[model samples]
Target: MAVHRSRRWSFGGLALLVSAGLASAVLINTSDAATNRANAATVTTTTTFSDDFDGAAGSAPDSAKWSLETGGSGNGNHELEYYTNSTSNAALDGKGDLVVTARKNTDSGLQCWYGTCQYTSARLNTAKTFTQKYGHFESRIKVPKGQGVWPAFWMLGDDLGSVGWPGSGEIDVMENVGYEPGTVHGTIHGPGYSGAGGLGAAYTLPNGTSFADDFHTFAVDWSPSAITWSVDGQTYETRTPADAGSNKWVFDHPFDIILNFAVGGDWPGNPDSSTSFPQTMTVDYVHVTTSDSGSTSGSTGGSTGGTTRTGAIKGIGGMCVDVAGGSSDDGTPIQLHNCTGNDAQKWTLGSDGTVRALGKCLDVKAASHDDGAVVQLYTCNGTSAQQWTYTSAKDLTNTGADKCLDAKDNSSADGTRLQIWTCSGNANQKWTVG
Candidate 1:
C-alpha cells in the first residue's frame, strides 16, 4: 500500500515512499472525439458553482465563497510553511487568476513544527460557503516548480468536524509533487483505506512536458458509485467501491473544495540549496457543474419531488412572504408582511419548482436576471422565470435568474417588496419554508 502522500502525518514520523508501482495503474485515456461526445451525451449538466478570480489584483478571495485557512501546524503533513490570511500569500491577479505564493519566510516570527517557520504560503477552502455531493468539479492551474513544493486541489467530506480525518473521507482531485514535474495523482482516502493505501491513479502528460510549463485543467466527474479523473479533457482512471478493498465507500456525502500550496512535508522533503523561493500556483478558474440526476441538499427553490408543500415562507424578522393586496393579478408585488395566515401569505412549493400564492406564481419581473430584479406574483405560466428552489441554507432562489429571493433593503416592514439578488448567504436572503 502506498502511504498517503499528503495529509496530517500521524504515523509517529514514519517516512514511507509511495509505491512506484502505484503509478503503473492503467490510465483509461479518452482522447478520442467519438468517446468525448458519447460521454457528454450520457449526463445533462448544469453550472452550480464557479469562481473566476476576476477581482482586482491583490484583493482577497471573495468572502462569500472562500475562506482562507491560516496556521503552521503542518496540516498533519509536517509541512514547513506558515499558512497566512494575508493577501501577500494569496490574492487575485486582476487578469483572472488566483495566485497562491509560497515564499521564504523572513521576520514574521511564526513558529512551525520544526521550531521556526521557513516559508509562508496560503490555503483556502469552501467549507462554509458551499458543499456538493455528486458533480463535475474542476480547476485550471499552472503549477510551480522546485523539489520541495506541493500543490493540490482536493475535497474533504462536509461532516469532517463530526466524523474526523479519514473517517470523514478525502478526495484528492489533483496533487502534484514538485519533483514529479510531468505527473499528477488523484486519490481517495477513507476508513480502512487511507494514507498511502488510498485508492487512485497517477497520470503523466504525453511527451516530456512539465506541468509547470503551462496551465492545464484537472477534474473529477463524481457520481454515487464512482469518481472519474481527467486532465485537459482527457479521461484517465475511475475509482469505484470495488476498489475500496472491502472498506466502506464514503464519497456519497457532500464535500467542500480546498486548494493549497505547501513547502516541505513527509511526501516532498525539505527544500535543498537547488530549490527556489517564492514558488506560486496560479489558478485560472474553478467550477462545479451538478448533474441532473444528482440532488443538491442546500439548493434553493426547485421541484419538491412532486409533493406540493403549502405553507408560509417565514423570512427575516419573522415576516411571511405575501402578495400585495392579496391580488391574483398578473403583476402583483411580493412583499414581507406580518404572518396573518391569510391567502396573501399562503404559498405552495409546487412539484414543478414553482412557488404559488392565489394561483399566481412567484416570479422575477420581466424575466430579468439582474440583481434587485423585482419579485412579483404573476399568473402561472410554467416558465423558467417562475421556478424557485429552497435550499437547506434557507435560501429561496429564482432559478431563471440564478439569484436569491431577497427582502428589499433588508427590511421586514409590512410592505417591504421582495427582490432577487446575488446569494450572499445573508440574513436578508434567508427564509424558512414551513
Candidate 2:
C-alpha cells in the first residue's frame, strides 16, 4: 500500500466545481491562477508521438505505442475492478476521443487474482514500442463522474522487470478520484519513497465547474534531473532528486506510459448507493515533445543563480527548514535542521506570496497571531497565514501577522522547532537563501 503523505493543495484559481453533491465541471476564469498555470503548460514544440484519437469508431489503441495490462488482482490496491483488454472496455469514439469505460462485471464465472470480479475496465501502457528518458508528456482527457471512478494517466520505469517497484519509479502525471473530480493529483514514487509517501501535489478548480463537464489538458515537462507537472498550461508543481532525501533517485531512466480507469480502491474506497456505474474516461489526445525550448518548470532556471528562491533557506545558525524524517506530510515541522540539498530542505518563493516546498505552502497554524504560533506545511489556500515575504535582510516574515520566523531558543540543532516571533534584529532571527 502507498502510505499517505500529508500534502498541500491550493484553491488559487478554482472558479467552480459543478456538482449536485458530486464532482462535475470546473470553471476556468481568465483571472484564476490555475487558468494561468494551465495556459502556461501548453506552450510546445517538436513531438515524438501524438495521437488525436482519430481512429475509426471502436478501434483499439495504437498497437505501436500502447498495449493492454489486464487482470483483476487489485494491482495491490485491493480494488474491485477487473482490468481487461476487451474493445468494449477501451475503444475510440466516432467523435475524436478514446473512451475507456468501466461497467459492472458480467463475467460471473471469471475469477480475479484475489477475489471475484465486480467491475471491469481497461488499462493501457506504452511499454513495447515507446520509452523515453526525458521530455514533455501531455494528454487531453475528461475523467468520469460518480464515486468509485479512479482515472489516471501515469508512467512507470521501463526497468520494472529488473528492479521492481520503488526501484523502477512511477510518475503519476494525473489522477482523479471520482469524488474529487474537480481536483487532480501528480505524484512521483521511487525507491524508499513510493506509495502514499510519494512526493506529490494537487491542483483544484474553482467552484461550479466540474472537470467532467469538459476536457482539460494535463502534462509534465520531464528532464534528466527534474519533473514539472501542469494542468492545462499552468505549471503547479515540480520534483527533483534533491527532493529525495536518502532515497535513490530512480527517474533518470526511460519509462513506459500508462492510462487506466480503476474502480474501488484504498484511496477512493468502494462504490456507494449514490455511486454510478458505466463510468468512462475520455481522451481527446496524447502528445509527447522532445523540445526543451521555452519549457517552463520549477527546475527550469539556471542552478547557479545564487537566489534563495531556488535553493535552501538557511537561517542564522546555518540550519534550514527540513522535512521531518524525510517525510512529505503536510504539517511537517519546517524546523531549522542541518541543510541538505533534498526536497525536504528546498524552499521556493512565489510571487503569489507563498514560500513553498513539495507543492505545499509554508503556513502558520490556524492563522493564529499569538506570541508563539508555529509554522508548518499546509495546503496553500492563499490564506493570510500563508502570505509571506522574504526580505532583503533575509528574514522570513508572515506579512499578514508581521512576525519574523524564529528558530526556537536560538537553537541551531537538528529537530529544533520553528515559530513566529516579533523581530528582534538578533542573529537568531536572521536568515539567508541559496
For every model shown, what is its TM-score relative to the native structure?
0.62, 0.59
Clash number for each model: 14, 40
Candidate 1 local lDDT, 245-343, one digit each (tens): 678888767777888898988887888998888899999999876434325443211110211245688999999998999887788889998999987
Q: CA lDDT, every prediction?
A: 0.73, 0.68
Candidate 2's residue-wise lDDT over 326-393, tens digit each? Answer: 66477887787877788778766543345767657788998987768998888667687986655555
- Please give the lDDT score at residue 130 for candidate 2: 64
Q: Show model 2 residue runs off by greater than 4 Å.
A: 1-44, 292-434
The lDDT leader among the candidates is: 1
Stretches of candidate 1 exceeding 4 Å from the true structure? 6-44, 298-434
Q: Local error of candidate 1 at 360, Å?
A: 46
lDDT at 2, model 2: 29
In model 1, which range of ten residues has the least summed lDDT?
A: 17-26
